[model samples]
Target: MPRPTSRWIAERASVGTSTVRRPDRTTWIVLGRAGADVAVVFLDAEDVELGRRTVGADSWATWAAEIEAGEAVRWVWNDTPRWYAELLAAGTRLARCHDLRLCHAILRDSALVRADADLRVHTDWDATPHADPPAAAPTLFELGAAPDAATGLPEFLDDAVREFARQRTAIDGSTDPGRLRLLTAAESAGALVAVELRAAGLPWDPQAHDRILRGVLGPRPAAGGTPMKLEDAGRRVRAALGDPSANLDSQPKLLRSLHRAGVLVESTSRWELAQYRHPVIEPLLEYKKLSRLLSANGWAWLDEWVHDGRFRPVYVPGGVVTGRWASSGGGALQLPRQLRGAVHADPGWCLVIADVAQLEPRVLAAMSGDRALADAARGKDLYAGIVDTGAVATRAEAKIAMLGAMYGATTGDSGRLVPRLRRTFPRAMALVDDAAREGENGGVVSTWLGRSCPAPSAGWHAAQSLASAVEASGGDETRARRWARDRGRFTRNFVVQGTAAEWALAWMADLRGRLAALDAVPDSDAAPRSGAVFSTRPHLAFFLHDEVVVHAPRERAEAAALAVREAAASAARLLFGDFPIDFPLDLRIAESAQDD
Candidate 1:
């Protein structure tokens, strides 16, 4: 097992697992299918069954709302979209949940768990979440039968109870149960947020989107015809190449054309093409840029994604191996900056747009307990602070050096400048170095919150073993060394990047609750297009990796901004308690997200 490297984790371990305790009033309600009705099993903090009840399909939503209104409870369910989507559409918003699928994935593979943990046993809980798109309307009762095997996850009452028990046992018996507990909670909360984000879709302006596309692409092309600007750029590129009939879209043909034109480039990639001073470079780059926009977020995309004044993207929680969320559809993660103007607030609403500055490095400083790095990142620009420390002569160098140190860059200017950072911030450098060494030796490494990277593949072990044998050839050694270094680079960055993702999740989860607590506006002032539960309230509208946009009534915009800042502070404290690191945001309040 990989040792815990975080000071906060060590401190938490010292304080014992009592820190995992929940509020006294909180109940754990497990819900699953019981024939045509919904089976509900209530448990207290001690994992003892408090009671059980079965509600008919017709009254499930109403009964759930009543139970939610009564006291603090965290619902445990098979899947978030399967259960929560209908609730939100029926105007029921949950405070918290334990998504068995998401949590099982976390605890089962966590490095902190015992190797013999029962949760590690192969089961249906290991199945991925179902792929069906969330229903737009309330269908809790109408969609009657329980999910079949095709849905991926099991939905029987017995399955939920057994899986929940196994997860609790794994956490309770883990080497660092507190950290695993926190990770599971955050992961489950992310599942809830994913569904809610779809429910309260991002406010979008289709007219503004079309206008931006027109301004950039020079008008939407008719079917089977290219836009004017794209066509002109293509014409310029072909003219520069002196091959009027050149096929710019075909890489092989384009390369051959470039070679014939004395461009002598090996490939058509923009970077390789830029190294030469050919007249074709500028227009070729421009053509590729415009072409990407045309295909990615073009007129076709606008017609498909945006509907009823909202863009609802499917968010897949824990979609990345690093525990980061990924978009399953609608290209939410790749929304281009050119279309920012299209993310418009409603008539009576404003957007609180905020994103962290230098988030990953700040996380690295705090997690590694490098007080010098933390002091530099306390309340201002982290790279500028590195410059003040004399680690590098310029802020640009400081940025490059810090990134190189974290990413294991070993060549060029980044490689040359990284030594200065190592000398100045040895503690921070040591953490990644140790992780790299571990990976090079075929060991697993974990993040601050205990999400472990996958172990080395069998091929990796075979190559390493073969290279160590007596009759190993020069070629075998070379390939083995190269693979080791690649794995080292991956593991070196995984700890920092994965922890940074956890911090971001903590930030969003806390902010989600704070925004929910704000007073709702009058129904007349509501942005009714936002959907049933979110129409009258301030809610999260959009989220990238390190940024969030909150759609709020103009009256609550300031409060929402404050909540955004407060949430950053809270997330830092949650991950690295009492550590002097800060996550500063470049925040703005505007009617259009483009203003920021």
Candidate 2:
């Protein structure tokens, strides 16, 4: 009789005797770096060793591509970006992967994991990603040692096997194995999507970008000069203050100028400026706007980032504490609306743009299992539905109330409206309120999928302790209360935002697979600019927190739109099974991503 599977079995490497390819069997191939060579270890569905092969560094791409050509296999590796980016550069595509580094981070901090799990003690797996994109595809023989700090864990076959075993053991011992399993799977899939999005860049139009800049700033300035419109605005602002040569770019000088002109604003922020009636306000605002465009996403930006009609930004998945993606370079997250016209599609193709209407509140409704809130969210406008329930007088009030409830607002209109929401939607209000109280009391709160908020800092604890003393000063108590409220706000928002991020990951992962399964276009119709794997098929081009842009052939635009919707439904179902909450998307199929 076969021995029952256990951690002991998982640690052992049993090389299969079969030399011939087993196309019918599902295999897990673990890739590792051996000194001046590449180590490939294969395991079958039950993880019994299938075989081991060492391919020369020079032939690694060819070997990997051959394996990808097979029926059913999932690659397992230390980091997706490190291994997959090179294979993608070589025109190889993969179906699935188990990213050990990402999964380790998830399991280590996950609230579901048992406290005694060994994964919690593996401090080596806590390394951050390399700030730069992966090193250029190296010659297999030259890829000797893993770069220090590039990965936290060892990049050898044995270490990979042992780490994978530890991760499995943690998952099996977790309080909620099913939820952790799904979260890990979704997190791994997000790793794949991040790499692919970088490989298959968003289509860009340089001319359109140039036009927007020119229209706003009056053409690019010659070397060592500001744009014509920006210079004109600066002159008007200086003239209004009766100092023709006053420097508007310098904040102190500008503030002094405003004060001298009888504008009693404390700062140069737009909102503060709006409160004033000074002649300099409008021109100063315009100058700041144009100056930002010049500095952030101007001609120099176009020259550096955009290449071959595509804007390829490096996406760092799980970078933010709330699990939202962060960009290393290319300013992808802050893409200005003015530049949307630059995000055009290739000829004979379309951009399928979609974003959830109000992801966080909808997520809160589902996660808290507040049937009333869920019913309010059954349609397109969740805020309007809240108004129908008499939570507030108007959609705007409902929005303010909901935002206040999730973000821990204590003042202004949001604060005033929040009480009404609490009275109407007690269950939904209770979740965030509890999270906030826990944070203020030095406790950690977790998202629906078990990603926990970070622990309170020593400084925070010290402040709270000082305030508890018999002789504590008013200032001490005030400072402590302020810090506690700040932490409360952070934890309160963390659960909603983090869970929303998980939903987005599931959506993108499902959409990526659906797009890959679509029919490929003929070579003549391929957009080679998208790189190898996506050149001939519909694929994800860009993803922000709750939005996705799919570049699809015109013939498949309708199908791609349907795929996107279906993927969203699948993600919602996977996250909140039978919760009866709906995630309605504001979807559009257009030649360019320009808003109407």
Candidate 3:
């Protein structure tokens, strides 16, 4: 790659004829492919083009590092994994980014944005990130091409600039620009974190994982064979059912076997099975548990996912409609607690594990501005605080009532306890109740940061319309009411859950920066398995909704723990801004993420 000569820079500067801002004044750096070269467009705070440069693929990382080192600028790109993955492989870690694809999605459907906003128009900018197989270090040039049908997002330089402008316009013209801007930034930051998490994978101890599996399932069996303990449980269940030929793995077969034995359960679900006073129940449950372990994170899973001491699960940021992340593979989101001990730190490092307590309820308190609920949640367990408020007799009841309120549960113990909560915390209860009503009426509800719940589907409208027909049948009305209530429950939780997701993003984003700021350990003590960009520093290892695990050198473990706690506080402040609500974490600094 040839270096950009002074004459080449001057010519490019003159071609644009835009007043070049000082390096310090550059606020955004947009990157995109330009033919065989990469176009780097610098923008000012107002999104005005400050200057531009076209660098070859061979020199892209070097140029990016130079420009990044010169000033604090947020890199604007189409997709994070496509661009940032290559940079990280080249040992170039960026502080921040503006992912156009992600921001476009948030702004386009956001209830806060005007209906007629240009961003609302269907465009390729609304495309999701490509679902490509995980590569160790994908090259920028190899990933760059014209917008393909696989991922509708545009790939060239001009496309990114136009999309960025549109996003800015949408946010600027939104009803609450401040909140929308924050949401977009937080969402984009989450995109970067997602890639980093995959690149700097969670450390794993394969031997420990094998041990846990053996202890639970009793030895790895031959290919296509069941484990010893699982087979034993199946035998015991079969014996109890008096059917030696019964296939415990088949739910239909198992149900028939149970009915033949007079267990008489409609389904083989654990809850239903537990209702019977039968000898098969215990062994059946045991079989199911072992089967889940084998299927989910068993020997096969360990062999496939854990590589070179790291478990690199592909994280799909903003995958859920409510802005919660979803894993495409490797079951990162569903890591079993029993196997958490396998999440081992490096020989010279420690894991700073932290997860927020009662995140959704606390978010409800803050978003609703429910001072009474906030007071109850101030510096103590939110449920215990509710107990103190006399909302319920015990902490367990307090939790049940709060969950019932948010989830729109209207039966059983939840139904009994919910009314007490409605009276005690009217503001919080009213907020969710209002959302439920809107959802039932086919309306949309937005999170505190403006991520809107998806509108009712066409099928929903058809059902609702059928129920309201002049000659509607009783079943039609019943089904419609049930569907409406189901939607109501979904939307009731959407606001709190979505907002909680935003808070988690803010927490992780803040924590990402803080961890980056910590001093790097000596090379001899570095955790090279965390990848080249993160080996020497305290980098985020794993993130699951409200929890985060940071792999840090022993020397920086305390600092990383402090960063985790401080980030939670920062996230709460960023979202609620002095709402007097707290997000306390259950934090532990240890060598392995083993449950106590």
Candidate 4:
């Protein structure tokens, strides 16, 4: 809990502290806080207790770093950021780890777990990382101490040991232990990559960002007033409405003004607004775009998030229920193409920008083993391949139909084209269709790699029961049906999306290792702006759902690119294992992360 340091040790090492020896294979160093000292429990690769050493708080990092330098060690800890952040700051890198919190989250909800596994009872492990963990200093499980305030997870040696044992038992006893093990490994690796991505921040050019803002929104405002371009757009909208005093920013007032002007839209949403053929539509849309830019990533945002030419956003891996990465700040995932020019690299260094082409659909192809779909996705442009299948008339129609099939679209062109897709690619269609049915029936569905969807809530069961009652009203039945349909769409996409996330994690983990093995550049040529651990070497600077941006020295750019490609191939093999589906990358090595 306290960064796995020496402070938890009961006593300091003597003047002649000897070197701690380990076996030839991997060792799991379990750490926790106990009173004034750090509790350390070392276990072998088979989970047998090899030895235990309690070091003073001051000597913990040094000891751990020494162990890390030695050979083949995997640190088993309750949380990654809590323990590894300090070591990383001290220029210590961990090659592999079993992150308990992340792995627990995966294993607890896994459909492969037996219904009576002891892991189901550890509700404390269900907590998000460091969400009001026990505040008191944790003691060794042998000491019978309380839970850690920081992690809420069992912090004592006995508790940690028991938890680890339980996890192993669950994994060993699962219906598909291999898939569960792969999911856990990938999830834990993702945890490490998330921290590293934050530490080695994304390269950002504030000057370029400012230039784009000024060009699009007109120069920054003098005080609190709107920019000239935004004001101009608003003026055009007011004039089009024939009411100079109309309040364009207020939804209610704008709606009334639209009604008065015969636009007659129910709401001011962009989609609804596009349906109307009014002069105000264009300017109103422009106004909305500028306003979003001004608020989300405008000048103020640049000052707060971008510093020293790097933008570090907090990445929450497994943040979405479907396992997509989510950003707590800096809008990392929603970066607009217009502003990608701002993602400039350090001098003498370049970014290897690579993203899988059609990641989810290809994942679907592999998991369902639809040879037709896999053949269609054998190369670039999966949608175009679908067109060749004669499922739809054009690539655009193919795109819509595939999306509809995954997302449960019931109306529009997407819905109409879905049936054609079902006929053409029945296996792939049946996979999602079955997931949807299970979700609607309140049965849990799992990803290809065993990440299960959250079970339906009590409210859901109640609604369904009420809908089935003899006294139920029409409104009740309609509401229940809508809820079920909404849930169906979620589970329908979960299998594909979650498996894609697993693939991404594997890709990044492999790439992280490869990049670390690359030769480090001289200090004079180093990008110190990337921070201490990664500044001297080719390290991963950024990662989104299906994409990664690696900052490498000019000379190592090609090697890094090759590493990215090789990692993708390895990840495919690791997950799908000889499946014909190929994950092609739209890769580029550029001085900036701008789209080509």
Best by lDDT: 3
TM for candidate 3 is 0.93
How many steric overlaps are in each model, in order? 0, 2, 0, 17
Question: Which residue runs of candidate 2 sit more than 4 Å off their true CA positions?
Answer: 1-26, 44-48, 134-155, 260-266
Model 1: what TM-score? 0.91
Q: For candidate 2, what is the TM-score?
A: 0.91
For candidate 4, the lDDT comes to 0.84
Please report, in order, the local distance difference test score of every candidate based on alpha carbons: 0.85, 0.84, 0.86, 0.84
Error of 3 at 226 (Å): 1.1
Local error of candidate 1 at 232, Å? 1.4
Model 4, C-alpha of 329: deviation from truth (Å): 2.0
lDDT of 3 by residue, 359-416 (tens): 9999999999999999998888999999998889999899888999999989989999
Model 4, position 281, has a per-residue lDDT of 99
lDDT leaderboard ranking:
3, 1, 2, 4
After the best TM-score superposition of candidate 4, give how far the Cα of residue 528 lies from its true spot, in angstroms: 0.6
Query: In terms of TM-score, which candidate is strongest?
Result: 3
Which digits, one per residue and each the tens of the lDDT, describe model 1 over residues 126-240?
7676544353343222234455453322246546777889999999999999999899999988888989998899999999999998888898888878999999999999999
